[model samples]
Target: MSIAVITGASSGMGEEFARRLIAEKDGFPGAPFDEIWLIARSEEKLTSLSEELDPKRCRVVPLDLTSADGIARLSSLLSEKAPQVGLLINSAGMGKAGAFASQSLKDVESTVTLNCTALSEVTHVVLPYMTSYGDTLPKKNGPRIINIASSAGFLPQPDFALYAATKSFVITLSRALNQEVKPHNVTVTCVCPGPCDTNFIKVSKNDPNATFTGFKAKFVTTVDKLIPASLRAAKKGRSMLVFGFGQKMLHLASKILPTNLILFFERNMK
Candidate 1:
């Protein structure tokens, strides 16, 4: 089965990835693993996209991946749908921005649940099926796993401490997993994107720091740029896909500068 399973497919990079696969045809065409699964908390939105994506080839399962029951249901679906899963995109994530001391406990908890726990659990369910399972299975490409991290994770977080820390964990874990899974014919890629124009802003609305007060939103690219880049990274066998020049600079700075100087910028970013 050439099945490519995507989570957080309702919007942003996940949605773009789905469209790219569908349009590219070879990767996700109208047949085979061409089947697309849209997972999110909103069924209405997912259903609409599924229909647009072609009902015969697309399926939607409403899920709140933050919950254990939701994760189990998704796991069950995976077992029933593609017993030999091909690609997994872990794009389900939310953002929070604020003074850590002033943020709500709920925000912190939910971020960990969806961004950290859900991503990891989905990886666990998808990995085994992605491997070469005793030959009788139809021949196809091995599984590719993409974790949506953020450029924010490259350095110490300021107001949005937990969100950055969680992303950092994803980047770290994905790289290590990539090394281990290489021998198993599996690829793990961590995509660290800088400031994209998505629900990220609305999600972080409660936090004053998210306003990006003086910055131009136009500088941020649409989710479309990320999908192709992500796939290219996967094809090249790279473990890291850090997007945008600003992000690259920050990542570089974090490495070259003294800890105190980098920490200063992180803490003082207004």
Candidate 2:
């Protein structure tokens, strides 16, 4: 059986991907799959989402990838199913917005665990189940992995230091893994988007009223725009996708400008 495995599938970009894949509403050609696996910590949310979509086609797997047990459970499920995973979107992540030292030990560790460690673990577990190029599956239907990174990863941020660093790890890992998997006909696309109007902000800042403003606010995007574009990029087998024009420029600036200069500007941007 062919399946699409989406982590963080209960909400935000992950939820959007599941909806688009099921509805096929986005202009991008949707991949055919016998099942779409919705994975997240909230079983209730996942079940609700599965019912909202076609439950028969959606399998809800509630998993807290930050913990070892969660990863083990996922691995066991994949082994038992042994399905040909046609698509894997690792959208599970967390971030804490504050000075590095001000953050609690738990928060700091959780961010790293979810955003970096879990992502890497989940990807490796799923790779074995992904369809290979020579598996008689049509090339157009070849397996694809979309990893949700951040434009913040292009450079360091003063207040959001750890989040940016972890995302940098994501960008580097995805790029290198793409090269390794290219020969197998499995493409890995890293999506680096700027700020978005999602639950992410509230959760990161630990405040419902928290949001981007002034210069930073201009770059905020919606999943409605980001997810579809990312899917298209994945279909085309692009290695990296910087979602917005502004974010693209930012990505370029990180490459051309000196790091100290960029950090200076970022520090004074407020």
Candidate 3:
């Protein structure tokens, strides 16, 4: 059976991606997944989204990817079902907003565990199923992977240290894996979206001492724009997709500027 697995499917981009997949009449452009497994920590939210899906077709896997038990559950499902993975979206991510030293050790560790470790594990587990599609490419409808990174991955964020670094790891992993799987006709696309107006921003604001308020409120994008653009980019087999013209410019600048200078500019931007 052809299926799609999406993490963080309860909210934000993951939720939006679920909505898009459900609405697809002829499957995702290049990749067509008939069944979708929604993965998230919030069972209630995942259930709510499931209501919008065909009960027989969609299965909600409510498990925190950050935990070993949660990852084990997903692995078990993969082993038992052994479904052809048409699409895998690793959108599960978390971040703490403060100086590394000021944050609790647990908080710092959680960011890395969820953002980097869990994402990597899930990808490792799912790749075999996806690659089982045989040696021949299925035209544009081959296996695809979309990993949600962040614009912070492009440059070093001073206060958001752990989170940014984790995203950087995601970017690197996605790019390298894309190359490794290219011959198998499986494409991995990493989406690096700038500050999007999602639950994430509200959560970040709740961090009292956090200095994340650089962009104007109006500039913040909705998930509507980011999700589709990312899917389209992935269908085209692009290695990386960064939304927003300003963000594109910033990503370009990060490549040319000195590390110290970029950090200095980011520190004073707000």
lDDT top scorer: 2
What is the full ranking by TM-score, best candidate first? 2, 3, 1
Tens digit of per-residue lDDT, candidate 2, span 1-270? 778899999889999999988865322223457789999999999999999999999999999898879999999998898878878999988889889999999999999999999999999999877744225555545688999999989999888999999999999999999988766678899999999988898899899888887788988899999998998898888999999999999999999999999988887887
- What TM-score do all the candidates reach, one by one? 0.90, 0.95, 0.93
Q: Go through the candidates in order and give each one's C-alpha lDDT.
A: 0.76, 0.88, 0.83
RMSD of each: 3.0, 2.0, 2.3
Stretches of candidate 1 above 4 Å error?
A: 27-32, 133-141, 206-211, 215-219, 267-269
Taking the tens digit of each residue's C-alpha lDDT, what string does model 3 give over 1-270?
A: 778899999898999998888766654432345678999889999998888776666798999888879888999999999888878999988887778898888887788899999999999988898887624446656788999999889888877888889999999999999889887878899999988866775555465344335464435788988998997898787889988887898899999889898778777876
Error of 1 at 48 (Å): 0.6
Model 2 ranges with Cα > 4 A deviation:
25-30, 131-135, 138-141
The digit string of per-residue lDDT tens for model 1 on 88-171 reads 789989877667878788888899989989998988887777765313333224467889999878877777778889999999
**Sliding window of 10 residues with minimal summed lDDT for model 2:** 23-32
Worst lDDT 10-window in candidate 3: 208-217
Evaluation by lDDT, superior candidate among 1 and 2: 2
Q: Assess candidate 2 and give its lDDT.
A: 0.88
State how far residue 132 of model 1 sits from its true place (Å): 3.1
